[model samples]
Target: MKWAGEPLRPQDAPALVSKGLMLADSAPRGVVYLSVPLDDWPEPADDTAQALLLQRAVDGSPVVTPQTVETLVTALDRASDPALVLGPGADTEQGFQAAIALAERARLPVWVAPSAPRCPFPTRHRCHQGLLPTDAGSLAKILARYDTVVCFGAPVFRYHAPSTEDFFQPGTAVYAVTDDPDEAARAPFGRMFVGDASDALVRVSDAVTASDRPWPAPLTIAEADTSGPHFTAEAILDAVDRGTRDDDTVFSLEWTSAEMFRDRLTITRARSLFYSAAGGLGWGLPAAIGLKLGRPDRPVVCLLGDGSPHYTIAGLWTAARHKVPVTFVVCTNGKYRALEEFAEALDVPKGEYLHIPDLGILDIARGYGLEVHRAETLADLTEYLKKGPDAKGPRLVEILQR
Candidate 1:
């Protein structure tokens, strides 16, 4: 907890709770603790303090100063090649639109930061370069080409595997705008600006002049080979894309084939995609259920790996009990593909533990009161997804991988 306090008497209760709420709503939001004695609950409340608590407003985000905006505008205009990297915080409604405007006006290539939890920029936009590599060496190599790098809402970097290489070139100028002062202070290198990401982007976009530079080439996806009996990741994602409308569908991804999913699916709006930046297991199922509950007008589909469902299998019961219309597509590869990737990166020896065999995922879902289907072919997967969202209750689709 960032802040903690205890109420010694009943009169202190309102002030403690008010302080906790303010701290929780502040930037880099987090939990706050309030300890109340058991005896205090029986005492009469302070009427004035309770009235003030009810009238309190949420704390506002840190503001972006005019000078900070001017500095960023000048930096972007002076640099020959500058780029924008966005993180989950930039996925807010205002930040999403502001990022697009800033990138367009400044003629900068945009990349989603590694381990981003939300879709900060439209994937199909011409300026989008794709997701940055998580490792230091690869991430540095990509940013090395640019003279300036501006990170919005993201840390300097987030890495899954250990690397000995430096994060950036010596001469490359790096600037970061984030509301979290802790993240700003912890950055290895950058000129930091602590403020609301949306406000900063808007101010910078307004002050910067439009550039005549040409846009970057759009990312291309290789054609899926569906001639085989089993389905490829590409083929499965392609079927999902063909089966759902982009505006009405939201994707909750925790699968191993993230890069392939990015290539196949096009997310053009904020909150259309969700992932966990913490890289924790069991986030996909519950997150999808929550997304469906919050956005009843939009259909939610969660894509998971074979082993991911086991992490939060109970989420299926929650969806079933609520009759939430969520479609869970499990790609049964019979192994933890992500762990294999990490092992390869770290040069660890392969072991039997990596293989997940004979997991009755569909049976588990069925036991939780969810409708289940096994897709034997590309056609079967497409037909199932097309109708899955319209169901009154939750459903699961099991697709065997090649």
Candidate 2:
């Protein structure tokens, strides 16, 4: 709140803003907020203010101390039956590649933590596994098979449901390598170390001898029959897979239900698959548009559920305005399907919390002035999606599945 001369003056606002920006830049990564008085709102922006706004700087990722790196390398060398969990910190291209290299060298099954903003590992790899579930009990059950769990760039655990079980069973060791010391400090039941994900991965890979254990087999996807009368979620995705073979299109899944079937779709690229690690909706459509704009050569596809797109459906207009060629496949089940499952799991009585029959997303997509297609049968869905990837403008295909 300190000012150059006095507080709350219109002239001092520029200096205050400048100082705030500087402080935000000089950080170990943090959220900084600047407060201005109500009287400051109507102030005029001069050349100095304009110049302040135009300044930009790049912050570099922090490096690990030699001592911490030694400790990590020693710990990894001793670990047998070690499993690696790649977290959100592995979002960068280098970090993702390093993780894969480390996993391959150590013969470890690489699991994507639920905190990841996108898939960090190639799903088609022998060591690659999908995301860890948010339930502590479920996560513990799966991790129980391993003697040691090594976490990178994410917390020891991020749970969505209440569970009495500990993150790991007795005698199972847990270790973490993260860039954030704050995260390392608060972590429960783990030997935490601080390091950049990519660097640490490389160091660990080099220090440890290649494991003699056999690499796990890659997951197999069962081809679904798309000749049925009604549209099933599996069939729709299979069709999308068939249609998108011409070009390597990045698929963004913001819809929660679609996330369940994500393993069905093969992700060969490191960062091509994206979703909200926090499990929030409304990011799919807009994210697809941004991806298209950033990489005009590659096509983008958004797989959104019936309820997910409503939060950011207006993104379609921006796509149309820019003529971004994104294929949006909306899975219309006519209800908040995830919540319905939640209710059933909790043993709650049947209620209307799961049902919403009035709204039509097709009409809404049409209102946004994008090409819309509704599919009642699998054949129809496949036919429309076959042309979806190469479509000139943004295309919306709504699959009516019960």
Candidate 3:
């Protein structure tokens, strides 16, 4: 009341809270701060305002210009090869369905944008390609293959490392359809259309004729051979893939070699695979615990690199306390492998600091009161993980990758 410069009116509380919620949920997502006096905490809100707020939350995308829509349609019609890049926005039910329909109709190769936390398009679909690289130059090269790139519900692109090169190659025509104008503004190159991604995709699908070209051959992801005794990231992931039922399981991956084998993993469904687009370490373990809490019936597995697990090792304590059914597979490569991989790119020396001391990760997991297993061999890792899908509580498997 003091903030609004009005007397404390109990009736105003519902509308105030609803307004704050609406602001926070609006396009180009951000936080909205609302101050409510303690005295007003228990007061009832106005019924009319509460209803209005609820209606606003369901507010659809703003009206789109027909000319902009026609421009996009014309561009796509002229393109010899056009691809769709579905971003975080496409993760929505409507947007996801529209994207898939458009891709299938156009016989387009669809790639998930880097910023997406969940896979929007069905990974099992023939048109669904794997994620685009986060490297600017690498992504540009991939996009270059398409005469026109139609990015939907996501930013133009996302990059982990800074690069001087432009986001798209010189000849490739780039277009983006998004609800967020900020996303369009931030894009380095593209003709951005401000509209609902799902609406845009649906309209484009209706306008465009089917391509004369045949559907691209589906990628053949070979199964990693875990016959060797030694445990490696690929082998561990392969075993995990083999042992777990894809539909009933969710994988939360950190920046690890297991992430490198994403294409080979059996995570075909949308939202089943989770990872940080920001490239932060230690989120995988804690995220797995959270996912387990959300989907109690599904098995949640965290594939963490040796270095990332340390970022949130304490998460295991919380998982144990709640008896959250999460299987943590720590890929122990004995060093900060990402740093080593980036040494040349970052122009840094590979030093002792990057090497983790023998901290006994199993002991750490045990200390957190988790059911722990140490797998020194591939067979041991596979055997332990075979029971992971049926596990009822927090379990940590330390994989020694030499």
Candidate 4:
């Protein structure tokens, strides 16, 4: 499906797609781009939403497609490969466990595509690549090689500037499965399977499995790239990965810096995830606050950028006034570095649009009565973060970057 606008919960697109696809028993072959919320569990549905659900589900299935166990049952039967590309989308820790249960039943290696980029669950799923940091070429390879690329809950035509070093393969079959009709209508890459991603995924897997066809060989786990300088982006993520605890919640605002973090970070068993998929700056800090408000017990950290801060500096005051104890780590790059990377990928010089520094966020955080900390290296950054909750805080840490 085609997804635009601020952002939708990672679950909504997939939930919509998976249901739609199962409604089509022939099964669709394409990519799915699931969009998830930056915060935990979906925001509670409003009364208007309740009315919408009731109106749609007068008898269910034709519309309300019961968020059922049966959908997954079908996926186990249909899967052509012994692995599942489980991504973000779908509410309910209960629903997640259900999907995992089915993955185990089929002995499928499950990897998360990370509806949001700040996830290392790729490694957890035993996937060698972190969100498959390949360019259009590499993605096309994955897309073409699969006899049936059943993407549950994602959009078509993913556009990334430095997405991968590889090139796009044309004419490869692509499919998008999403719950939202607008998402389905917008999909450009492949035919869409509209409905709940979780359910459609389950149904397709079950259908493929029941077919008893020879499943594709499991994708080989990529060996560690121990090449020179170890300059790969994942290396940076690896450097900071050890600092996170399983229980800690992660909120990142810098999308470019995300490669290092997502490629390297380790997700614990009980973890919460958030990020601005809309690529909007400044949402990071507010998102951290939102995540905290949604799950106040966990340590929530917002990894930020200079360009993005201006969009939401007021978030500091709100966090302070509300007494939400979120940790803010500003990766002190000068400006919109992610945009710069995009320009380079397009073979253009840095845009005139970039090249502006901001009033140091540190002073502003302190002005708002937050505990401000500064770190120039990983060691220092880790130490400041370890200081734990401050009675007078929402702590802010500025980590000087090259």
Candidate 5:
């Protein structure tokens, strides 16, 4: 939360609420709480209160100065190899388009930041270099080739596994553009520009000289083999990608095989993919329902791990009751694969509780009023997803991964 306030009197209620709304709608938007006493709710409003309630908050993003734009343009033009790294903040409509324009104009390879909640650039673009690794050593090795690195709306780095290596190699110049002051301050080494990233991207794109350098190699994914009796995570993700190849399809993902999903699926449109930045489980089911509610014209496909359904099983009931047309794909390996992987990464013994051999996910979904299907092969999964556009209500497809 960025702000919190309490109203002591009836007259203060309107002002506090108005201020809270403004702060919540501002840059780096977040939650704001305004508490009011129960007695103040029924009080009569004065002219001042009425005026405050009628006020509207306009866009307050700071304008990028000419000198700041020149500094960035010079940095990009002087460097032999420059790259752009984006985070969830660049997922907005304006920011998405601006980032693409800047990357194309400056001939910079674009990489999504680690733990990104949204896709900032077109996944199929020629200049895209895929996602950055979450570990410091691997991430540093990838960025070491670039002479200049400009990060937009992302921190200098975010790590997952423990590492003793430095985040950047020596002689690598770094710059950042973000709306959050705290993110700018927390950066280990970088010249920070605190403002709307979209504004800065636009200004820099206009002033920067077009580079004559060759574009990086396009990303490629090997085809998944499906000759086996049981489906693999790669096969399931490939089926989902092929089933929803339309531009209007949106994906909500919280499955364990996130790296596989990133490699297998092609997301060419901005805001087409959503994930939980904080690594929260059970976000897939509810997020799919809400995304469908907001974007009624787009088809929403939710991918979840088998163990994640237990965390928010009631979301199926809500979807069924509301007749939301979201296709829930639960990849069932009959265990919490993420937990086991984490334990292995930490070089610890696996816990006895890691195995979930008795969970009946399909039965629970059907009990909650959803139509359920058990898919044992890629053909079965593909057939089910083909009917997603005409689905009248919520449906769950369980893909058995043995």
Candidate 6:
């Protein structure tokens, strides 16, 4: 075997690194924090210190801050209030708390401008309005009506001054708060405020009075289990919708669920969820495994595309080896639906060679000793998914898209 430093071939100096992971005692090239900011994250320069009162903005507290909480109390003491838009680039967790507090205090509607991910919430504080977007135009429309964007985790505005067509109604104030200086610096739309997101929220609570902007009501899905090729996607989604239990966690789409599954499945998200606004919730199979690992008692479901599952097929083996209980409900359309959509947009017929690998995911899952079920009809699919917990182990339910 080749020694650690030894070159594989002749005439070469000893290699300093192998496969990117460095040897012990080697300085870390960089640190990647999952969600929480790193303790060792480099301090900002003196010039950047103007944002924070202290010479150093060290605590990196994003979620809740004392100042924001105080602000919230003050706001609660009031009656009418301002419409709140938790803009991008703030400490999301603290911002979420602050938003919720403000909403409760005002006894009015509160909304997370762009997402529905459930994290950093006290288990009791899971109820809040997630914004609605039917299309690009709708997203812009909502952003337009608000006078101010109270950005916490995300930046205030994504404006292309080149075009006001997308801008929210002429001129709107965008204010931002976050623990991270980078977020404050990079916030494109609003005046940046630096502090714990919760603190910033508290500050907003202190400053603004309540407004009459109606908080979006909790999503009420009109469920229909219809049949036909025109309705297969909806039917399958209806089954997923009906089968979903509050105890079940869904990894909402990093995949291209929008192409086929979007209109069909009504996601009732309030708790135990992770989704992306980049519309990037991939048919997150491995992510589902990780979610299951973190919250083993909860049944994690990954609704993936045929293409997305291939990216992390190895994770299935890991699930089997560890006996991680997850149900991978693959929405198989036999073809790449996104690509097909593009084809239609370009007025191009799907090429004859637009073929997918013959991955019998059911057989593959069974090979790994997972309980695999394939449903041809809605009733069977619904029954299998609803009763998955009793299926003994990791389950993979395959439903044809027609």
* RMSD score of candidate 1 (Å): 2.4
Query: Which runs in model 3 stand beyond 4 Å of their true positions?
Result: 1-20, 29-60, 63-69, 162-164, 222-230, 376-383
Point out where model 4 deviates above 4 Å: 1-83, 107-123, 127-129, 133-135, 162-176, 189-191, 201-240, 269-271, 351-353, 389-392
What alpha-carbon RMSD in Å does predicted model 3 have with respect to the real structure? 4.4
Model 3 per-residue lDDT tens digits across residues 1-402? 112322257676667666666656666455566656778868776777677666764575464588877888788778888888888766665666777778877888998886466677876789878888877988888888888888888887777755777766788888888887777789888888887777777777777777767896776666565654456566677677776746767888884655545765675555677878667788788889889889887878888877888888899899999989788888776787777778868788788988886878889989989899987776677688778767778998887674
| lDDT, each prediction | 0.85, 0.74, 0.76, 0.54, 0.84, 0.54
User: Candidates' TM-scores?
Assistant: 0.92, 0.84, 0.83, 0.68, 0.93, 0.65
For candidate 1, what is the TM-score? 0.92
Clashes of each: 0, 0, 0, 69, 0, 29
For model 2, the stretches where C-alpha displacement exceeds 4 angstroms are 1-60, 222-227, 376-383, 386-389
TM-score top scorer: 5
Tell me how candidate 4 scores on lDDT. Answer: 0.54
- Which parts of model 6 are misplaced by more than 4 Å? 1-82, 86-98, 107-138, 157-164, 198-225, 229-234, 248-252, 259-271, 276-283, 342-358, 390-392
- 60 Cα displacement, candidate 4 (Å): 6.1
Q: Write the residue-wise lDDT of candidate 6 on 78-149 in tens digits.
A: 423334544333224444555566655454434444443333232223333444343334556665655444
**Model 1: residues with Cα > 4 Å off, grouped in runs:** 1-17, 30-48, 259-261
Provide the lDDT at 353 for model 5.
Answer: 88
Considering TM-score, where higher is better, how would the candidates rank from best to worst? 5, 1, 2, 3, 4, 6
Tens-digit lDDT string for candidate 1 (1-402):
578999877889888988888888888776799999888988998898788779877746797688888888899999898999999878888889999999988888998898787778987788888888778988899999899999888888887667899877777899889988888899888899998887788788888989998876676678987864667888888887877755768999988655435647778788888887777888899999999889998989998888887888898999999999999999898888888887897899889999998999989999999999998888888888889666999999998876
Write candidate 2's Cα lDDT for 6-86 as tens digits.
236766666666666665544233345666777877888566665866675545667666776677666666776678888
